[model samples]
Target: MSQKVREIRLDQIEANPNQPRKLFDETKIADLAASIKANGLMQPITVRPLPRKVGEQGRYMIVAGERRFRAHKHMGAETIRCLAVEMTEDEMAVKAIIENLQRADVTAMEEARAFQSMLDRGYTVAALMKELGLKSRNRVLDRVNLLRLNPEFQTLVEGGNLPPAYACEIATLPAALQVKVIRQVSTGQLKTAEQVRHAVIALREALAQDDIFAAMPAATEKEVAVVNRMEAKVEQIAALAALGFKDNECTIAKKVDPNKVKGMADKLALIRNHLLQMEHALRAAAAQGEILAA
Candidate 1:
């Protein structure tokens, strides 16, 4: 429910214990204070009234615009403008999450943790989409999966020092290897998403080989041939895919229209169909327990 805008004592408003954004940038708060001080408060902060003690007056907790509230405090303002909303704790939690998720500056890890908290409260993916105005379930799930990365790596992601592609590949490595790979990333030794992905695959293959030699039974000649063939296929596909990606940027992407190359789209479509078939075949083999490593 909504209430009219009113002036409230800065001291009377409390921070929401369930606020989704745990971290705040002090520099941004100072900037906001400067902006508010110069331009006057352009928008009133949103707040929810908390349960009051016996014979006490109304007390408020921020539901959104925490930075604005802090900005007001920083300027030593005694009272600030607010919209006093009435809501249950659950409603406040959901509202706070939606508000923060809508912000452009929300970090990937912050979004991940927020979505996880919603999932912890039994929110279905569909429900989360409706509540958060997201179009795809995969978007929410992807953010939540970022929590699986080591916190240090997640910090790099959150701080915008690491690209999401590199982080995804790093997440596939063992925790010990993840640290080393992250150092490579920080030191600029591992540049580009493709390099990181290739490094991850190389490490994974090495580990698989180690496991096979340490514990697995000896491979027959036919099994060895199959493994070699599979590796060759992967390398071929990876090389072709990399070429295709780079070509895309220089071909039609450069604003050059070539009706000269007839059936270009058709050729790509044929390749896509073949790729889909290969994927289905691999999945079917795995379902039948036939694709285990040596």
Candidate 2:
């Protein structure tokens, strides 16, 4: 393929109608355009010859770099420097997808859609894995799973309303439950990812057998101790309030100030996060039935 960077008028370059990627965030495009204006195009976009009829004006279709192309248009740039290359339609599509995916910020859903498009176009998963430098089939499988998610969930993800990790958890639920969770999240009934995760676990357990909460392990000594300390702090604060101290004074009267309370909260959060990590590790180990020597 011939490679030469040429400055072409923004109006002359056209988006390929056959491009596999359908969704583009206008806000993200605009942001990219602003960045381009400040720090010029760091990477050149790839394009191919536009199939035109005889006696028609020659045009070039973007094989990749649609984001850059759109950004240039939004920035009202009269011209863009692009790498014009000669390639077949299939080659252009594949190259374009690979180029866009090089961006670290590309969403999992977008990657999945791109992979699915390539698969539909006769590219095998193995081929895609090689092309994309992906090591595991499960990595590709995870992205493809996003497509199976409820459309509303997909919309939330594409709109950046739902984080990919949370979205992945939502995708694991049944379609009916997925809708229920999405509604709860959108309505602010579920305010955090942790809450959503717990809800999902409860729902799954409930479905497996009634009264699942009854089987939940009793609070460990550490957890109980943490709860007791928190309750004691609250009681002390309340007693100070009862002593006629103003709210602000009561806050200051505690042996541990608000900052200490915040520090304890942070410590608790770290413990909780560590426990979650351990739980995941144990589950993975159990799945593989691999025993640790130690």
Candidate 3:
């Protein structure tokens, strides 16, 4: 239920533990505090009543507008404006995440962390896209993946020192690779986002070329053709055998050929051996591909 906006003591209000935002820019808060001092607070922050403790009576936990709360606190305003609302934990978390994501100053890393919190609570990507008004599943996935970024890169992105888009591009890479690329950006060796993109591409391609599997001999065009023909041959033989194995029309005794059975067993063993070898080679190739892409 909604309660009327009222004046609340700054000391009585508490920051929400579930608040999505972790970092608040001091300069922005100072500017906001100055604005509040000059124009007065234009909007009342949302809060929920906290259970009165022995000495901490009449306190409230912020449900939204934490930035405003901080700003008001900064200005040493004894009494501030607030609207009290009752909300469940999930509701409060959603509101906090939405409020922060909608704000211009919230960093990409913060947004990503908020999205991840919901996901950890069992929310699906499709549900998050709908709730957050994101246009695509891929976009939501991108935001969630940002949480996987290297801690140092996340700090740079959070501090507004690194371009978010470039950080996201490297977030797809392994953590070691991300640190290496970000170090180049930090050193100003890679001046522009475009330069970073080109460098990443060149690095990935170089890694791919150096892959051990890439050095391994691949199937020749003729070998590929031969493999296809062999598959067809096996299919034809299987079909023929199925036709003869009719439940009512054939019996093992009637169809028995001891020599042919022995021949078939030998061939199956050879096939299994060939398959094992192929599987090993394919596994090596897959591992190499992952490393290059990483």
Candidate 4:
């Protein structure tokens, strides 16, 4: 691509329509404007020639350094320095992704949407890793997964109140459970990514177990140690219950109907699995506490 440096009028320049970055901090822009006013622009923004935009005078579109362009406009400058490059639309899109991603100016959600945009354009995860200079496949996928989170959690990620690591774990839950985790975080109940990971796993397992209980609830109880929103307890009230043996043999108690045996066995297996999960969750929470104490 051909490239050269020159001065361009602000009115003749339009922001790139395909810019990957969506959220820009006004305070930072104002700070940039102040810096430019004091020391002149330390670096020129890059732009390419484009047709005029509707209802706006435009001869060029920004390929990079939009913040600098905004800073110049903020300072009421008539002309700003520019690095003009020639590239096709596809090349321009890739260039924008690389430029913004290389810097730390964007939020996690912005990076996610940008990665998604490129993926939608037919790029594979491996191709994206190579193109973006990212090392880990999970790293790229983790950012993209942030898109699955609700807008409220997304805003927390964007604002830096919640790190993307913890948010990714929370994103694996259903909407209501996601809100539950968020509430826990806000209340300082979950303070680490490890804790959040364990918590989400428990919530997911609890969800599956809830479905089973709802389908085959022998009895319900009002209170439990775990705060599940569903009917929290099931007690066997059958006249002749199926019993589990430690010798790996399935046995139905005397007089138990053959049709009811499978259901009883399933509930027994589910309860056993749930206990194992609860044990693991407890261990994980304890580990998190130890980590914090250390």
After superposing candidate 3, which stretches have Cα over 4 Å from the reference? Answer: 53-56, 187-294
Worst 10 residues of 4 by lDDT: 233-242
Summarize candidate 2's per-residue lDDT along 204-279 as a digit string, tens digits.
6545543354678888999999989977976885585477455546544366666678877688689679768977
lDDT (tens digit, per residue) of candidate 1 on 1-294: 867799999889999876767778889999999999999999998899888889998889998889999999998999999999988776778888888988998877778878888888888989988988889887787788777799878888888888877887788778876876777677787799997776677667666666767897788999999989988987997786576555356444343256644576678689789889988866654532321221
Q: Mark the regions of model 4 whose C-alpha exceeds 4 Å error after superposition.
A: 52-58, 211-294
lDDT of each: 0.80, 0.76, 0.80, 0.81
User: Comparing 1 and 4 by TM-score, which wins?
Assistant: 4
What is the TM-score of candidate 3?
Answer: 0.64
Which candidate number has the best TM-score?
A: 4
lDDT of 4 by residue, 56-141 (tens): 65488998899999888888899999998888886778889988988866778878988888898889999988888889998788
Ranked by lDDT, the better of candidates 2 and 3 is 3
Considering summed lDDT, which 10 consecutive residues are worst modelled in model 3?
A: 285-294
- Return the candidate ranking by lDDT, descending: 4, 1, 3, 2
Error of 2 at 73 (Å): 2.6
TM-score of each: 0.67, 0.58, 0.64, 0.69
Model 4 CA RMSD to the hidden true structure, in angstroms: 10.6
